[model samples]
Target: MLITFIISSALLTLITLAPLLPSNHWTVRVWEFPRLQIVFLILINILLMALLIAQDLGPFLALVIVNLCLLCYQINWIFPYTPFANTTVKMSKSSDLSSRIKVINVNVLMSNRDAHKLIALVEQHQPHLLVTLESNQWWQDALEPLHDAYPYRVNYPLDNLYGMHLFSRIPLSDITTAERVEQGVPSIHCIANLHNGKQIQCHFLHPAPPSPTENEESTERDIELLGLAREIANKQGSDSLPVLVSGDLNDVAWSPTTQAFLRISGLQDPRIGRGAYNTFHAQYAFARWPLDHIFHSEHFELVSLSRLSEIGSDHFPLLTEIHLK
Candidate 1:
């Protein structure tokens, strides 16, 4: 019984972490691989445990081979090859970066009290562009001091979970809610004019989380963002303007769909070599992952990226500085 319990717990742990495995096989990965492999292993374990309870050794030993294969395949998680890994290869050729830009993204839990923490973080980072998710009128009021620092603002603070506010030191032109899906669930799309006369088309999004309370299915949000990413990729192959799509994607970086988003969008993940800048579940440090992200087109270079201190919310603020060449 003890051995059965041990095997069951181990298998459950493996299943949970399975999705974080690397997916650059040029074959199959993440959802298609890990999720399938995990389900198969869990069933096998259950069958083997039942056999063991019945004093059946033959089936248990046969299941051992399946367990071994699953364990071996699990090694892909040791290193995830994201676009950030590709940065070094292109660095030598990017020597003519003219101007730099800084961006900060945060998801302040709608009912959080540490509004001052976010305010201080903005003051400290002094980012050129800032985006806050799950914000309401209360949050907007708490962060009012930032209005002076960032003269140009696009505030849409609503009680709904989709509320988002964007503050930028640079001039934001043609500011409007992106019409990817429908109303209520808002996403900000704007063209930012930098001090260097360069302009970047930016998309700040907060997709619905795949939880029972928020969103029952993730299809709409996933497809909406993917469609946006695909549009950006089409532009990337022709245009010179920098493009960035950022916010809490609510999906793991190593997921198969996210990999497809990368393949389809042609955007680069900024957290490859930097390690997982886990920024959720602030109260429990161990229960966090890099839900917040900043993916950019090839027209920019990363200057710096950081996860700010806890702001009494469920997520930590992500600050990124980049230079356009």
Candidate 2:
């Protein structure tokens, strides 16, 4: 019994930590560490109680190490989401409409070569802005017809997995990429000018997954995103500015790390109460979670959000429209 408990507890801890390893699928991977931790703690407590009932101090003392591990796990789990509340009580603000913006973010696999489907999605949604990840020159050339409609463009096509491109019908300004952490990986950050002359900062990101073929760990990608969120949150009146951080975040909405990012950045998820609109590996519908996300500051209200039909890519495009206050 002692050996069984020791082995099972150790195995659970190892499985919980396994996601720390790199993998392209790490973004959507669900590591139920919290539940595992709870299970172990409950088991340990029950064991101690049983031993105490039998008046056998040996087994109780023997399980001391496992108890300590559970304590540590609980400590980490207790970390707060974010310092800011969901909505500020001091500022009872109404939603914005003049600053409305619609965006489409898609990770069109480089090998997809099905630009026609992408074009159809664009024509159907008519998003104010469109950002594509894993897009190469082939994708850039395929999407040429869109340039005529969406005059503003930012193309940083790379053969590397991090290729990114952006097209917007609205005027965009202050366009720049975070070159430091986003080496070969390309991201588009800019300010969009609405019809009402409202300017909102938009960021499109597609970080490398933590796969053996890609990054060794998701820490760098996760940290970079969290850092950006913190920067946005620190900005005074950031909520009023109507900032949007969207893309193939490669992380699920339920992940603790992803939730922390949302809290620290003062961003609100549009998918609250919405079903998990999984986007990746569309072929395997059952194995899907909401990998792509659109997180925005408080000033906007979600008008529409959905996943488009498959377009010969592992990922399905996500479209979100928000009325900006």
Candidate 3:
């Protein structure tokens, strides 16, 4: 038992620290998604080691210490999502009706056909803007009901899972879509009108995740996100508009690449000090992470962030309300 615990504990400890290297290999990048699960494993392993202390006291002590360190590193990255941390975007203290904007982002699992669930959410929340990922021609037809309410839209539906669609009640101008990282994987860039007649620069993305079925490495995702971040940060420097990027980022909020993107873009994450707001794996409680995200500039203040009811898709809808300060 002691021998087994030591070997497993040591291995887990190394896996936990793998992402720290400046590498985007699939093996290293994949480690970014399971920090929370690793923490649980570390805790349980520590308890097992303590109970089996009779085997090799010295080795067990070293393993326990390493596990503890790994635990701290993982928690530090996630601490921003906890209530104890301070929020990056502050909601307006005043009841400013004209400056408010509501946006919802959802990733409709490509194979799932529950269009009504998503349409119902749009009706219930009445978001100023709605962005959908993994959308296709059928999903577009199912969502036709939104046209009456949201006259302005940009749709790029495809049978491939990388499809995207955006609908807004407010006018959308300067709209364009691009395949930032790989061909056929499009990202939307546009400007939306706020209640007070202000223009908010918006960018929506659904970066391909690093997986065996998809790209074998995180290179494409990182390049796409970071490249856009640099551009947004450049325009954001003028400080004339409130830049907002919302969609299924396909990356966790706490990952190193995500943090680097934020720093490069100078965009503020509303999830900071709020909560994990895990949107993926709607069906599984054991395996989940905050994959969908809304990152905006410091020009706006956060109002409320909440997860909507399950829509039969693997991801639940995320609703965010913000006040343009």
Candidate 4:
């Protein structure tokens, strides 16, 4: 029994290392999805090893050491998301309420038929801009009431899970629907003119995840992020306008791809000092990571960010308020 336990711990350690390879295959890419689970298992394995340590002193000690090493590595990846880490974006202390803009993002799971909860949330928040993904014609009709309050709209309501719709009460100009990396997947890009006479370039995306049911590899997802990052990078400047990018990114905030995108685009995540605010798999708290993201350039400071109530979807809506600096 002791030998079997040791082998099990060693196997878990190897599984944690599999993601270190440079392969984008679904099997390898998926390792990034369960870091939290791996960390938990590592801890439990260590405690079990301690109880069994008296059985085989040397071997069990080695097992505990290995688990500790893996635990440190996993924690290092996730520590920046806790309040202990410095925030990537400065918090907004500006008292100018007019300069503040609130944006809400929701991935209304395509198969979810109920829209009453979603509609209610909209009525309650009444954000300056509301972005929705995986919305079909049915959703479009159900959300028609938005047109009354939100005069400006950019919509691509398709049965495809990648459909996107942007509703804004503020002025939206130069709106464009782009199929940057894949045809079925669409992204919304436009300029949001704030009441303070400032323009915020906005981009909303929902890239495909690496799963057996979806793409077999993460190449498309990686490419889509890189392309968007490059576009944002090109626009980076000292006197450039503020830019906001948000949606169900379908990737963890701590993944290499996400970090690389931040470095390339020079955008900041408000969740650095804040908690994970993990939005995906809303029903499973322990199994959640930050999949829905809101990233912005240095031109804006954080006001408030939180995960709103569920809307019969797998993801919880993300609400972020920022003040242009």
Candidate 5:
């Protein structure tokens, strides 16, 4: 029992410090996703060590101190997302419908055939904008009915899982499909003309993730994200246009890359004080993280943010409502 406790503690400690290294290798970056899970394991480790307290006070005390420090470190990064923490984006009290924009972002697994489930959500929410990732030609055909409701559209359907589609009820202008890093993977940029005569710059992205099969390193993903951040920062400096960036970033909210993107883009995360709003791996309750995200400039205030029901995909849809302030 003591040996098992020691091994678990050692492994947990290693995982806690692995991401601290300055490496973009998939092995290192993948460790960043399971911080919450690690926290849970740490608690269990502490409890097990407490049960073996009679064995040796010295080693037990050492392990407890190290685990406590790691716990604090992990909590510090995720603290802002907890309900106890103050919200980064202010709540909106406005009742004006024209100034409000409700968006639904989903990563429909390329192979998943239950398109009707997502169609149901669009019908139920009646969102101003809908963004889908991993959408192929078949998925596009499946969602053809949405054309009437979402007249302004930018479709870039591909067999590759990085395919994206942006459908909007609001008038979209200056729409462009950009490949920031890789040639095939594309990102969407457009201007959404709100009913209140306000225009917001919207960016939709579905960057490749660092994984054994997808990307051995996070270089391309980081380059794409940071490049967009720099452009948004430059544009925001001259004109404070309300900017909305949403999609499957393929990076967790607490990751260093995502944090850098937030800092550079000057966009606010609505999930910061509300909840994790985990959207990926919908089939697995224990193995889920917030891979999908909706970030907007400070010019918008939060109306509501929620994780919608499963749609037969690995990722659940993320529904967000923000008021253009």
Candidate 6:
């Protein structure tokens, strides 16, 4: 029991400290996703160690102190996502439907064949914009019926898992599909004309994640995000256009990269002070994080934010409504 406790504590400590390193390698970056899980394990370790403290007083006390500090550190990063923290985006006070933008963002697992579930969700929600990631040619065909309701569309279907599609009830113009960092991975950018005749810039991204099976490093993902942030900052500086960025960012909302993206772009995350709203790993509640995100500029305020029911994919869909302020 003593040996097992020590090993678990040591491993938890290492994982807690891993993300603080500056390396963008997959081995290191992957550890950033499970801070909540680590906190849970650390608490268990502390309890177990407390029971066995008599056997090894000095070492057990030292481990407890270290774990306590680590617990505080992990909580600091996640606290803002809890309801205790003040909301970064203010709540909407407007009742005008024309000033509101409703969005549904989903990452349909590339090989999952349950298209009807997602289609049903779109019909139920009837969002102004629907963004789908990892959608290939088959998924595109399955979603064809939506064209009647969502007349404005941006489709770039590919066999690659990074394919993205955008369907809009609102008019979309200046649509561009660009390969920001990687050649095959595509992201969609466009201007959405709201019912009130206001134009808001919308960007949909599905950057490659850092993993052994995918890109070995997070450089490309970071570059794509930070690059887009710079562009949005510059554009807003010039025209002060309202902007909304949504998709499977492949990074957790609490990660350093995402924090930097929010700061640089001056965008507001509705998740902050609301809830984590973990979207990925729909099959396993224990192994989930908020990977799908919807961020907006100061021009918008949150009307509603929710993690919708599962649609037979690795990720749950996110439905967000923001009122133009």
TM-score for all models, in order of appearance: 0.79, 0.74, 0.96, 0.97, 0.97, 0.97
TM match of model 6 to true structure: 0.97
lDDT tens readout by residue for model 3, 89-147: 88667598778889999999888888988888899889999999999999889999999
Q: Model 4, stretches more than 4 Å misplaced?
A: 54-56
lDDT of 5 by residue, 1-325 (tens): 6577678878988888889888989998898998889988898888777776857767578778878888899888888878998889999999988999999999999999999999999999999999999998999999999999999999999998988998999999999998878878999999999988999999999889999999899999999999999999998765668999999999999999999999999988999878999998899999988999999998989899999999999999999999987
Candidate 2 vs candidate 3: the TM-score winner is: 3
- Higher-scoring candidate on lDDT, 2 or 4: 4
lDDT at residue 25 of model 1 (Cα atoms): 27
lDDT (CA) per prediction: 0.72, 0.74, 0.88, 0.89, 0.91, 0.91
Candidate 4 accuracy as lDDT:
0.89
Better of 1 and 4 by TM-score: 4
Off by over 4 Å in 5: 54-56
Which structure is stronger by lDDT: 3 or 6? Answer: 6
- For candidate 5, the TM-score is 0.97
**Per-residue CA lDDT of candidate 1, range 1-325, in tens?**
6466566746556565544555322222223323433545665675656666567555466445555555455434413533344343133234443477789999998999788888888888789998999999999898888999899998888898778999998899978886466467788998999876889989998877555576655566677778887787777646557888888877666565677887888778777755667777678754555778888877777778788898988888889887776
Q: Candidate 6 residues 144-191, lDDT tens each?
A: 989999999898998989889999998988999999789999999999
Please list the Cα RMSD from the true structure of every candidate, rounded to 1 decimal place. 6.5, 6.9, 1.7, 1.3, 1.2, 1.4
Candidate 4, residues 45-124: lDDT per residue as tens digits?
Answer: 88777776667668567777888999999888888899998888888889998888999999999899779998898899
Q: Which model is ahead, 4 or 5, in terms of TM-score?
A: 5
Candidate 3, residue 182: Cα displacement in angstroms equals 0.8
**TM-score winner:** 5
Q: Where's the lowest-lDDT run of ten residues in candidate 3? A: 232-241
How much lDDT does candidate 3 score?
Answer: 0.88
